[model samples]
Target chain A: MAAAARVFSEKGFGGASLEDVANEVGMLKGSLYNYIKSKEDLLFAVVRPDADELLMKARRLSGTDLPASEKLRQIARVHVEIIDRKLPYVSVYVQEIAGRGISQEWTDMDREYMSLIEKAFMEGVEAGIFADDLDVRVATRCFIGSLNWMTRWYEPGDPVRARAVADQLADVFLAGALARSRN
Target chain B: MAAAARVFSEKGFGGASLEDVANEVGMLKGSLYNYIKSKEDLLFAVVRPDADELLMKARRLSGTDLPASEKLRQIARVHVEIIDRKLPYVSVYVQEIAGRGISQEWTDMDREYMSLIEKAFMEGVEAGIFADDLDVRVATRCFIGSLNWMTRWYEPGDPVRARAVADQLADVFLAGALARSRN
Candidate 1:
């Protein structure tokens, strides 16, 4: 899966060949097919773990008895941690999900993951932990819009800086940068 | 350039070929080559106009003697308008810019465009229009983050809906959705 992710990241989903993955893994093309049905299936296998990891983390955090604000912070922290631990897989997931004419299964998985985040926002708003008037859908999108782009700039070894960025982003979404005293 | 944008948007920057653009424009590849040097050059041409349009619009609005609030509103409006007017080109730009091994010229152009946006945020902060504690760089990134993602979901010929979404985003960024009276 790691070999497949590197090839996919370099050549893109449409451009990558199964033979390249096989070469990287030091296996013949026929032997590679023994383990994976097809290139698309291989792509899915490479990305599925990262997606599962993200979903699992979100579920575990939501199961906690914390306030909505703390839940959001946990969500942010978990996301950063996942990206740090599985950088290449997460990178492939981010890049390939946006491609046109994606499979229905892929689209379904994308929406399912997004719905987890959306539910978190809705829960927060209802709990009065986040802004009451917040458009939960748009806020959810904004959260995704901010966090997904981090894959483009984040360096895995720099966990401290990544945490600082996550905290700043959480603050921006929660209280905003506006001076509270002025209000 | 418009034809090239369409081709690039439909079949990503790396996926698109000069022949495809030529076919779309009712010209031979040889004829297309007379106007542009390569696929990369054609992409640069398609993207450069929008950059110029955005920077020019920003400058015109900021150069106005209006108050900072109105200036910020105008900048947001211009950004939304660009998405409406040039959705395909903007989509191509966002998708292509994130991948591996882009040219230095392209990188410099991207930085230049980003700096233009950062300048507006800086001006707002210096004028005491935005919050003092607002990190101008992060604020600028947030704005771009919000605006750039619009291309993903915005439907063409739905200007009214687009405008509403844009206004809501502007409100979220400026006043936040925290029920301001309570705040």
Candidate 2:
């Protein structure tokens, strides 16, 4: 799975071959087939687990009794933690899932993942925790966009710095930079 | 140039061959040599011009006596407009410019382009036009990430929608979700 994630993240979906994954694992291509069904299966194996894990965490956090602002903060923290923990898999998810119609099941799973985030934002807006005029759709995209790009540059060993960055992002999103006292 | 952009964007720089570009142009691979010196030359020709044009626009906009906020808005608008206008080339730029040691010139050009946006953000903060706590580095990445991802989803014929979306993104970045009155 690690080999598959690394190769897929590096070469993209259409560009990577099963043999490349096999070579990385020091296994014969035929031996790889004994364990994984196909290239698509390998791609699914690499990304789907992380997606499911994220959805689970998101669901657990959503069910919390926290206010919307804290919920949003928790959501951001969970997302950053997941990316930091599973950097290569998340990298594969970001790079491959967009264009390649690997499977309808994966696509639906990916949408459900996004819907989870969107729901959190919507909940915040409805509860008057977020600004009234906030466009949920655009804000959701921006949140996802910022999180998605982290895999490209985030270094895994620097969890403290990563967490700090994530907090800053949540801060920027939840509260505008204007001096509230002045207003 | 358009052919080269399409081929390179679709196949990536390492994955694409000169023959692919030649085939896209409905010409023999050998005949392509009449127009360009090499594959690297073709890539530079397609991408550098777009970078040059963007910098030229930035230079012209910088000369204007606009306030920092308006200047930043204009910079964002220029980014979206350029991506909308020259999508294939921009797509190529997004996909291929990273991880290429031989393309140091293109990499330098990209850094220069990104620095332009970063400078605008920093200037806004300095002028007290933007929020004081803005982490200029992260904010700049968020801006570029949002703009660059547009190539993955943007439909060129829908200029009205594209511009509207760009405006929404600028609003989200500059003012954030929190209302101005609250700020």
Interface RMSD, every prediction, one decimal place = 2.9, 2.9
lDDT of 1 by residue, A1-183 (tens): 999988987776666788989999999999997898998799889988778788788888777878766777678777877777777787777766732338887777667656777777778777766677777777667666767666666678777866877766666666554445544
Q: What C-alpha lDDT do the candidate models reach, one value each?
A: 0.73, 0.75
Model 2 lDDT per residue over A7-33, tens place: 987776667888999899999999997
Best by lDDT: 2
User: Where does the lowest 10-residue lDDT sum fall in candidate 2 chain A?
Assistant: A174-183
Report the lDDT tens digits of candidate 2 across residue range B14-114.
56889999889899999999998988788888988777887778777776778755666777677788888899898777665632334667667667766
Error of 2 at A28 (Å): 2.6
Poorest stretch of ten by lDDT in candidate 2 chain B: B94-103
Candidate 2 TM-score on chain B? 0.89
TM-score of chain A of each: 0.88, 0.90
**Which pairs of residues collide in model 1?**
none
If you assessed candidate 2 against the hidden native complex, which CAPRI class would it receive?
Answer: acceptable
Encode model 1's per-residue lDDT on B105-179: one tens digit a residue: 667666665676676667667777667777666655666777776676667666776677776666666655343
Regions of model 2 farther than 4 Å from truth: A63-65, A99-102, A177-183, B11-17, B36-41, B59-65, B98-102, B180-183
Q: Candidate 2, after superposition: displacement of residue A2 in Å?
A: 1.6
Candidate 1 ranges beyond 4 A from true positions: A19-31, A63-65, A98-101, B26-31, B61-72, B98-101, B123-133, B177-183
